[model samples]
Target: MPNIFTQNLGETPRQALNWRLGYAILCFGLMGASRGIDEGLISGTVQQKAFISKYRLNDPLLSESERANLLGNITAMVQIGSIGGALLAFLITDKIGRLWATRQLCLIWIAGIIIFITSNGRIGQVYAGRFIAGLGIGQTAVVAPTYLAEISPRAIRGLCICAFSGSVYLGIMLSYFSSWGSALHISSHSQNQWIVPTSLHLMFAGIILLLSIGVHESPRFLASKGKKEEATATMSKIRNLPEDHPYVQTEMLDIFEQVEREKEATMGLGWIGPLKELFMTPSNRYRIMLGLMSQLLAQWSGANSITIYAPTFFAMLGTTGQSEKLFATAIFGVVKLVASLVCALFLVDMLGRKRALTYGIILQFLSMLYVAIYLAIVPEITEHFQPMGNAKRAGTAAIVAIYISGVGWALGWNSIQYLINAEIFPLRVRALGSSMVMCFHFANQYGNSKAVPSMLLETAMKPQGTFFFFAAVTLLGLIWMWFFLPETAGKSLEAMDEMFNLPWYVIGRKGAALTASAGHAENYMRDDVEKVIQHEVSHDEQVTSSEK
Candidate 1:
């Protein structure tokens, strides 16, 4: 209707939400929703194990080792598919536009869902469905964050990028609650046991595919492909402004100049350009390496471990009944979902990245330590089957500790990793860079997901040892994050290179503090943008003089 973009350009980008930005968020959020739904379905497996067993996945005729292996494969199938899918996304994200790649992934997700709906408990069919769906999940992981990052204005980019993670946690909570609800009414042996949970994934995937049809292609992608006019038009449309709008013009010029500089820097490198730019450049490599490390540690933050095995974790908290386990797991999911939403919307941009991470990790370590200590003290009452006197109190404390741990995880590692992945890299290699990081993420998640079950049953350390192990890992993660993680809130994507190129000592401060000390970082960014545009202007003038 009326031009909201014109009025908003005068306001801070963070405070303004034009129709285009709203549209972008809506599209990206839907993609995030599907991811959340898929995660909920997969993690629902913890509750659906009996359904899986009824399907003969854990057939008694098979040897114990055979059953364990099959069960392990089924659990890890999505992660395995995700790993492969990330590799594929890495190779093709730049070739096809982000929108196109996402469209393709939606199709894969739909196909996977159809396979699951019709599998009829055939193990091969079940694995095939998960694996196929995983391919879509893997690609979505890279593309969605990258898309949101590219489209968002720097002032609100952290919050916008965080929508992806927030929606994911929302989906996880939805799955937990929905599965718990279904568990109350349906028999474990009923055909609906698996069908109801798996159907949610199909419904979400279909919604994502339908919504994606209206999404505009990323302006950065268009510019990178040498379509300047189209890139400018897309940027204007996305910003809800005319092409001549000063804000739109400035934004377009900045992107073009940065893209040009990248091209000049990597001239003659040919097909290996993006890869070389990512790893061979010292600053870029460090940023990506840190991103990879963050992702790896994020998986180990014990959040995914809890989500995938919340029912088991509840059992250890002195809740043995199936209904009790489901109810507890659902509550844990609710805590995480609430914490994640609050942190994503308020804390991420408010506390700045480093402080949020530090505080979150600190609390996380304490929560895990509480678990380890409680379990170590009461080793006799294994699996919450018998809680006598102090044991009952200890179990109650452990359950509370689990809820606190979910809150800690939601506030910090869960949302921060994706934001870092989106913000750290440049346009040329952003897709490849993000894909590489996510590959490590999915791999570690797969390992942790598989390891949790084995840690509880097979390890000599038992469940007590597993809690101790995670607590120890959480401590290490805390140290690693404090030293290596930089505060990146409010910095533009184009300015990342200059920002990272600064000394490590300076990079450690809060983004606002850094900006204050740097004589207004926005001015610095504007100056840099002007210099690039000026260079092009002077070169044209010189050519004209020479010809005359």
Candidate 2:
């Protein structure tokens, strides 16, 4: 039902804005879907007995510890691919362009999907497929936010990126439901359950490839490439206005000015310039640290563990059967999807970045602590054991706590990191800097995914201890956020340098960096408008004198 172009010719500007948003969503939608497919694979893989059997995980020939190590490797390999993909995106995004890089990666994802569904229980094929698919995911992670930020109006930038983040949840929910349906209807011993889930990845990749066609390149990128007229034309088309329209002209000048400033700051270092620039100044250094720390906090807060290993987590909570655990995981996905929508729609811009994260971390800490304490008191459910009534009630409560913790993550950490990271750097270094931050995220994600399963199953902390570890990390994250991250809501991309350069306390205060930047931009725009008006008036006077 979605129209690719704006309907109703001669429509109001508001309708035009709607059309622009529709186009953005269409272009960015695949980024989220790819993420969902990437992260969602772990959920079904951990649950698929056929996948386990394919590798002889259940064979009496292997020791339990060996099987654990093998499963860990399988689950963690995707992160390895992600890390590789991040590096590749960094090298290519600036050189070739965001749209081109994204388009090529989507093709790779389709190829990976083909390999994945046809692997037919071959470990080598599956691992290769996972790594290739991860490359696509990594590229999307680094490019989507940067691309979205450049094209969006400042007033709605956060909202649009939040929607992009929400699509990841949508993909995750779709994955869960697909796997749940497959598991219910497909034979447990058949490979179809896992294959059906993977096929969905192919569907998403195809959509992304199709939607990517003819999407305009970032105007900032075009300007950086020294194609000023092209950049202006692209901006005009994207804004649905003439090149000289005050709004379009104002934005074009802002982009051009920022690009010049960034060139001077980096001394025109080109590809390697961003790395040096990142640490050359104290503010830039701090921003890099902020980006890295934010990602680390997002990972260590333990939401990902709950996401990738939900079925296993529910089993720890004493769910009676495989079906029950899968269904519970599906419910968790639903909660996460709803929470993501709330964040994208109501919180990110309205509550401001700092407060939303602080509140979300507090909620996360409480919920994690509740789950840990409740689990510590309740007995773990053994395969043949029947739990008492109160124990069953307590177990159900623990599951609810998991869902609440997921909500906390969605509200604060989920999309905010991407939005913040995307907003912090100038265009010259935006892609490289975002890739650097994404590398940290993917690296931590790899480590976490690899370690959490073993930590849950074999550690001194057991399942309860894992949550306790995450709660402590959440407390640390809260402290980091309060002192470091400033409010970026409603600020122009060109204003970020001013925003970050201000003292920590002054950064978010009312009518400080944010206000000054807006006022400064207005001054330039006002001058341009006045100049045009004067020129028109003078021309009319000359014509009147000539007629006389």
Candidate 3:
């Protein structure tokens, strides 16, 4: 696999990249499918004629603004619920551990989907079900990445983490095709059109839960809880090595040392310790700020809005009918999925996080600028305006621009937003910090998802203005990332502290360079482990002589 992906395997042990580790990552990575399916499913589900008729979403009597508000409310409810879910995820992940957390969230997700499918014609039930589902779906953002980072080897950490990100597009693609297939074969009047596709939520959640049963809890999490022997055993099993193997010993020592340091730093602080460390410590405060800003910039960049409302956006771009719009959206999903896979398999580990982000954001900015300019120049397609000659060519270009934006998004913000938060913090506050980050993630997502419907209206930002806003945000994000986002590729979880120890202004720009020159913790730990092993061997021999 490493040969195929062309990942620089670095100095990582061959045993650490074994099948057990891969299976665990696969189980957790699929959690991203929960959010992906929801985002893709809802957009097409709402566009169904039966759904519109049953829910009266397109009622003739409702004003355009009112109808837009309703659509926004319906689409954004899960994100609203996700805010609360993310806020509480740290508590759940901390209390029960990652494996149990996966189980619980899956159950919650399944229950929510059941309620949603049985809603009949009740819009309130639809909202309630989706919001409930969001509770479970939201936790995936925090849990999967944290687990993946904690369990993975440093050399391929980016690849492992991006696996989760990539699965998001996999889910989106499957949901898009399911919706398109249902629209083609199922009767428009039948509720089965949307319900059948909605069942995908249940399928993915169930699969994740089942697969997780065989996976081990994160060894770092175990170490944090003072379960040293168990942590060593788990680490050995995951890495496919003996407990005394140099790789296993060095990695465990790193975890133990970090745990001890954190224990001292927050000894008397009790439950507030992690929170205090997160907010009061200068480095952690900076980390939290980065986490928040990543989400803020990513959500507002307009790529996510394009994803959630692909059909609507296609219609505005002059795709003529529902079938054509759905087909275009499905193709859009395909583009995103392929791009995300490329990021996961090649770009992330090979290019490094900062460079990957830089390149991706550049692509996003160019694409969004093209779309915004085209929309500004062309007559409004939603007003029954049809293009010909040069106008038609420009519209075609705009459609291509939208697809390029998805590619850029999958490569950049979509991967980093989850990866950065998961890897940046110390293990002590990893869950808490990730939870806080995802809380803001969902909050900003809710704002973007809800506002986009109205933002596309003539009375508000309009299609052109809204895209212009996205293009501007994308440009700002590119600048922010260049100056602030450090390269985190091939760095161990324990090595992150030294990476951020520089002055805030210089850290993002120069931190990676400093960390590289300073020597990695893994190298230091390996030297230390050899000395400890020799000392223990000598002591055992001395004891043997005394007994003889």
Candidate 4:
């Protein structure tokens, strides 16, 4: 049995989300998961499959090579469009609350589907649709994880954030299943056959649109915008507290306190101010680097590369069933989701920040190294590089092995990276930092979207080579973790600020880490930081009320 609350959840007692919110989370999680086809590869693969089949593509005349080129080009087009959408996320988030941002994303998804379908499988038009669909995925990629994290309470925050990642796998698995279902050999008469996946994708867009309306506005968003009252009310509903509950009061106060601090500090950055402040300070600069670097590790770790091209990767293994293999990927996604959920419970707050990061990095590093060796050592096993004979059997064994290794990493970084980032910054700067990190996450994710295809299309651009690159990056990530990242658990956002202010040499020295030394100054912004923190802390109000 799981205890929902641990560590008493702040002095002001954290608000609990009700069953309605629970249903909302489930619906949205499912909605977001459907976009995996949009993001990971369902739509891309289906479009190509339909294109190839309709043309009855075969050798040089029918040209599998031509189809490959077409697929690569169309996929790359979506990726290019995604970069623009991600950059736009920083701006959209402020205007549209996460819920509405996702709605906007669903609309983009719907547009992509309509365009793709209306083109009637025309190659040129499908590219247009992909670009449009990519826009939604890019936007959702930044917004959904963020919104889920913001609405969720601190206690189960990791689970909520990871659910977004789970959704990614969920979306992709469904895509694979959809694609496998559409295995009819290509013919010009059936050029629109790709519509199966695209149409299903349209369904995802519509359902998520409806689901988006159900969740409360993010408490963080409400707090950030100075909607203290509405923010408090939203917090109350989600946390299952009464309208005037002490928990609601504390959260309201914490939001105001953050507001109060921002007022005292010059809003030098302005609209572009947050962006400027983000890069201006060394403490934040390092965090941005660390966050991006960690995400780079996750992306380059071959985890995502494997996903975008699962059928192709499986073909390399001499494995007979692309459908089975895709399902296996789904299993990996589920396992990662479950593992993250478990880790969120015991290790999130307990393992300390540095420990969780290092552990995740270690697992990701090891998994990438293993995958590199397995693929390179047995490239000859299958036609597509899948295992053959007993070698095939062993390679099949290795696929699961490699996947589990990646899962080990998810237990650490997948959700924790977002959780860690949320805690790493002081409230004043958290959103900027988080969004920038989201930018990096999606940037590399797009890189993954492109790179995996390049590898699949050419043996010279081997998957093993990609894994090797990941292995090298893993080494860099470890050094960064050792040198720069600090333990952040059990400490409030105020203390986290102090931790970030120290020189590299002084960062991990327990005595020095906690106590500011002479000449090297540390400012906790003690008054403002505390005041801001307490505004959202309903439990803290109860304590004061009781003391009075």
Candidate 5:
């Protein structure tokens, strides 16, 4: 419970605890549950593989590729559901507040799980539930960090949000453990291979349901809509800090100023008119382009391809020890969790979001390079392992490498991309903009899930070639990001609009007038972040800080 660093930072005691607990529950729990259910390789594929062997369907369906596509369809279905939830963000997010929205999402996820388990293990029901669960997952993806960014002390907001990212990768690793459990033939359904994992997911989803209700909503949402008393009450409860605290007043007043501007810009038409206006404006168009592209690029990185196919790829290399593979995957999860903490704890506020993203792209470049080598040049070595028993270690090593890519993922893949989306858009269109990106993101994800599985199944034999293709793509994405995407570090929506080429109607009083009167967003956000070693904020001294 004691640390050498934060031990004497001169910060309030409960303040740190407040941030950590909120993060552990809201961000961490969301990541753990959402991705936990998402790793189709965990329960679905293992189960399907088992069925193929059991029913003698393997002879026909084992190599059919359609079977895997079926599984990918299920994966895509969840994203499809997320697109729907994101689309609804404008109407629902602030109204319900971040905490409530996430809880509602958790409940939706639970319903899907219940349907999945109660249907006598029907694949159709499973897919249907996936669609529902995906919707919840998508909402959490948008809402969790949105709230974290809103309510967090500006000094450590990025770390809090990134924690959510760490939790997601951890969840994926957690899901993979289910497959390992199945492979170990432990519990009731290991005889069938995937049944244990399926039950395991339902159990986890149930736990998430219980956890969801305990979380508090974002105080920012409450204040933004003129719910002053409620906002104060929520902040008090969440921070366990009194309304008189300097930090609480700073947050509330900040929200008050932004909301005052936004209320003046309110167009009676609600989401419809403004949704059209956002894209119609030139500057908004540029912002939207970058936001959507960031998300699209994240998906194109083939993150899922590496994640879902790790076990199967390991198998092709002849890795037979189910237990070891699971442990390796778990280790990868721990790495991601630890790395995220490091970033949240020290690096984020120091290096800045733009730098963090650049760092992630660089990591992806290196990891994917290794992946390419294994795929293109390793075929001869794989053949040497021939049998599963003989090749298990090589296969497991391959999977471990795949998890290395997961480590980079914790850095920028999901959280960074989403952070950009969340940061760039003005409050007026935040949910809508995020939803639009999610929709596009899902559309892209659908293509990757479909294409990559088929690609790997056909080409995994060539170690270098397969990885080289992805590596090249990742490098290209890096270049594209550097040239096209502008830095968003610390600038609020209105200022970012100015940085882009946004028309006044989007972030200015003109945009405010288009909807209501007060500007819907602020322009500057200077976090009281410490320097690399430590820096103090002076009451009268001007401080310069960068943002994502």
Candidate 6:
């Protein structure tokens, strides 16, 4: 049977999708679980009776504002560390290479988790540990997608890159189950209640570190460093093709040509060349705007806040009791996981990036709108007031709407936020560009996560207002994307320049069409590869005869 993934392979060699490449993508993709596990586990962990009692979070003397601030600080600390981590990642990845960077970050993640679980009664230690871990966890956002995009075949690039996004929900789902199980199986008075679920951080980090040992460095990074022979060998191994194979040769040529072009564009600029190119060039500046805005819009859409505080949101929506709220949150994680898988397997490649985003955003908007209206009509529901008849039914639908919003998030912003930054920039500054974008990604996320507790307060936005705010942001994002986001599916990394070359005003709407019309050469045909091979063979023969 033909592989469903290969439907878009066009004329590309089948060997490009080998087990070695799969293993590598899998290894890097697991990096996403680091962030997911934290988001899922922390909400339930903090709510654990033992944790709250030990930390004095439930002290009767504590005001609502103080409690909100404390919760925000605890949950948002990792994002703060991630901002620094994202900034540090470019330097680390560029200097030590992608594989080593992964290993180092994994170590940082494990160390932070160790400190966190052993915090005992000290809240400061909890903060310090998560902050330290954020340094490593944050870098994964920059590193994993960058590595996946660089190595993947153009046909399956979306599928490969979405592996990272998909694993996020996988981590969330597993962590949710872990948290739920601990809550049920362990006594609430025992420290092990939260400690056992937190151990998952160590397990994921250690597994990724071990797996990194077997994966090779990115060929694009090797080519950029002027190690052409090593790059070719690495590419050959990843593609499961011989060094002399025309497919491998063509790929190497694309990488080399892009490197040479970037060199010419940044000549005499020294070590700061990539920075200068990123900021000074019109096209790059526009690309940066797109990357920044994508993160901004995605983060404020309130989907992530919901993920981080799933139990809180469920409680607010009328799900009572610790066990009941946690069960609802676990199901929320499952919904997100399934949605992410659907996006990875079918939507991203089949529907194209723009359309997938459009559909996802619409789902998000409708869900948010329904929830907002429900909250507006039944503001007393959150105060433990029971509703009768139709109002109760509407309350249940609001819960369903929250779940639908999770689906929308997985389909839309969650997938695009990571995938777009990875593919949008030139190879010369791919790491730098992705790092900078993710710094903002985490920064905005920190703001959203840190503010949501307060935002949900009666003095602030309140429940109806918060959901309304999210709905408004979702609508704005849909409009911004319609005007600015171009179709990137099936396009080669090197060919992105052509797509971005279209005028800024029309680029989002017409760039892909224009580029396709002009026929940007990706050189996927067998005949094209054969010609390149014959030319190289003839040149080699001439050199041999001349030496004689």
Q: Considering TM-score, where higher is better, how would the candidates rank from best to worst?
A: 6, 3, 2, 1, 4, 5
Residue-level error in angstroms, candidate 1, position 144? 0.4
Better of 3 and 5 by lDDT: 3
The Cα error of candidate 6 at residue 510, in Å, is: 1.1
lDDT value for model 1: 0.76
- The pairs that clash in candidate 1 are 318-384
> By lDDT, is 1 or 6 better?
6
Which structure among the candidates has the greatest lDDT? 6
The 10-residue segment of model 5 with minimum total lDDT is: 517-526
Error of 3 at 303 (Å): 0.9
Error of 6 at 475 (Å): 0.6
lDDT of 6 at 276: 98
CA lDDT of 157 in candidate 1? 74
Between prediction 1 and prediction 3, the one with superior lDDT is 3
**TM-score of candidate 3 on Cα atoms, chains taken together:** 0.95
Count of clashing pairs, candidate 3: 0
Give per-residue CA lDDT, model 3, range 1-548, as digits (tens): 65843347655667677889989989999999888999998889988888899999989999998998899998999998888788768998988899999999999899989998999998899899989999999999999999999998877888899989999999999999999989999999999999999999989988998998899999998998889999999999998999988777767767887898899999998999999988889999889989999999999999888888999999888997777888899999999999999888888888989889988899999999888899899888854579999999999999999999999998899999999989999999999999999999999999999999899888899998998999999999988998888888877888779878789998898888787733234573345555656644675687699899
Which tens-of-lDDT digit does each residue in 92-196 have in candidate 1? 888898878888888888888788668776878878988898898888788889999888876677778878887787777787777877777877777686578
**Cα deviation of 99, candidate 2, in Å:** 1.0
Local distance difference test values of all predictions, in order: 0.76, 0.78, 0.88, 0.61, 0.59, 0.90
- Against the true structure, candidate 5 reaches a TM-score of 0.79
Give candidates' CA RMSD values in order: 3.8, 5.5, 3.2, 6.0, 7.8, 2.5
Ranking by lDDT: 6, 3, 2, 1, 4, 5
Q: How many residue pairs clash per model?
A: 1, 0, 0, 33, 31, 0
